[model samples]
Target: MLGYQVPSPDEAMLIAGGKNKGSTPFRVVTGHGAFVLPFFRKARFLTLSMMESEVDERCVTRQGIALNVRAVIAFKVGTDEASIVAAGQRFLSDQDQMSVLTGRIFAGHLRSIIGSMTVEEIVTERQKLATEVLDGSKEEMARIGLGVDALQIQSIDDGDLGYIAAMSAPHTAAIQQAAQISQSQARQAAAEAEQESQRAQAEYARQTAIVQAQYKAEVDQAQASAGQAGPLAAAKAQREVLAMQTELAQRNAELRQQQLVAEVVKPAEADAEKTRVLAKADAERMRIQAEAAASHNRVALDRMLIDQLPLIVREAAAGLNGANVNILNGASGLSEMAASLVGQGLTIFDSIRGNLNGSSAEDAGEPDAPEPERPQLGDGAHPRPD
Candidate 1:
């Protein structure tokens, strides 16, 4: 353990006083342990870790503008044996000098690269400038047993010249205008969003109000219907009752009219007809009775006239007897006077019978009978006794 040595993961062990293998002054042992006699061999350690170097230099651009350029380089010692041997031989005594030497080397390259480019290229194309610087210094850094991982240009400016600022003026102005436009657009979009939110809220409120109004209207209508329900029902019932009463009254009136026709009008008509029939029969009977009476009276009157005819004849003859009695042909004259007296008596009898019969016929409402013919006597005819 005393004569054996091990190197750290980020370091290389260099044996300087041993028998070396290649055309190098040290034995580079990496990633393992080795045996070293303490008095016979001299060993040292070289770091293989990552290193950072800063380069800040003033350089002239292709446009004759002097610019201060600052840059950073990330480098490390190489992993191979030749690279280890080279790094150990150079930096074995002082390992911190690696970063210094790397910084100086990159500074020279940075100045040379920046001189070939314009200030615009140096400002805008910083990656290109770094890449070219890295590429130009690649072989030289490798000879010094260093490998570059990356190169970054930190800043580039013209000191008191304002050339970079003057050159970037248009782009800066364009960028500011673009920024202002973006801000205005953002504000406009925010305002539009706020208006849309307000509109949505208003619409929601309006819809809610409409729904509430409809609900209230429906409720009011329902309540009003409920309120009118009893009155409407009562009105309907009253109408039905009135209609029934009216129908009953009409039926009663019709029944009364029928009863009057049966009890009063029909009986009256029957009584009137019976009375008329009785009156008619009495008138017929009275007419027949009068006709019979008139016939009887006429017969009696005829009999009485017959009885008085002889007397009338006698009287006439007597009257004649008392009158002037001169007879013209003696027996014939007497006979003629007696015949005239009988004829006159007969005429008188007929007249009396006709008058009585006419009176009787008039009383009986019958037509008068015809009078009989009177007896006629000749002037000189004798009266017959028969």
Candidate 2:
């Protein structure tokens, strides 16, 4: 085991004094096995891993102003055959000096790149400065068997000059003025809006008060009108009651007049009519009775005179026998004389009956003659006999 040698992942084995010796002496070994014998072969470790170096230097800009530039460079031992041989030849014995050599190499490139650029370009475009340094240092780094992974400009300072702040003063002042103007406009608009809101509130309050007053006035007027209604209605009721009583009294008077006509005046008039009719009927009855009596008397007297007529006729016949009166148609002539005498007696009896009836009717207190009919005033007045 003491005679054997091996290399790690970050190491490349450069074997010398063996079968691989004297040609280029570079053997890349990784993870486990670059086997070598201690007496007959030799192995050197060359790191292929990344390494970092800081570049800080004061360099003059294109304007001849000195600027302090700080940057970082990430680099590694190259993986190619030629680059590995070169790095193995150079740093295989002193691996710790790689960072020192890289820093020096990038510092020179940074100075050269800064000398070609202005302070504004260096401050504003840091990446451009880094890129220019990286490109300029590429060939020199490759010659030393190194490859750059990245280069970053960490910071740049002009030492107390305040050149960047002085350059931005005009733009910063313009921005602040714009912000102040926006704030002032916003406050003015808010004040105007608040004033308009207060005016509207006052107008609304005025209109509301007017409306409420009008409503209260109307309510009081209505209350007053309501209070006066009771007496007016009472007076109207009294007038209506008087009018009804007057109309009732008039109606009662008319009823009483109708009752008088029906019960008292009508009956009195009917009774008077009935009395007149009865008196006239009584007169007619009396007249008729008296006339009938006179007719009976005249008939009796006529019958007595008819009995003496026979005697008278007999006496005349005797007288005629003594005188010897000559008569042609003798029996016929006597019969004719007798018939003439009878007719004379009948005529005298009729005249005496008429005269006696008139005298008797007058003596009996009968009316001269009653009218044929009487006008009836009412049916209820007349009570006919059953």
> What are the per-residue Cα lDDT tens digits for candidate 1 across 1-386?
89899999999998878777678877888899999998899788999999999888988988888888888899999999888878877887898899999999999998889889987777888889988999999999999899999998888778888777878888889999999999999999999999999999999999999999999999999999989897998999999999999999999999999999999999999999999999999999997887777778778888989999999988877765545555566787777666777879988887888788787777767788887776576556544443
- Write down the TM-score of every candidate: 0.52, 0.49
Clashing pairs in 2: none
List the pairs of residues colliding in candidate 1. none
Candidate 2 residue 183 Cα shift, in angstroms, is 4.1
As a TM-score, model 2 comes out at 0.49
Model 1 residue 5 CA deviation in Å: 2.4
Clashes of 1: 0
Task: Give the alpha carbon lDDT tens digit for every residue of 139-248 in model 2.
Answer: 99899899999998888888898776666676678877888888888888889889989999999999999999999999999989888987998999999999999999
Runs in model 2 with CA error above 4 Å? 1-6, 21-23, 182-386
- Per TM-score, the best of the predicted structures is 1
The Cα RMSD of model 1 versus the native structure comes to 23.7
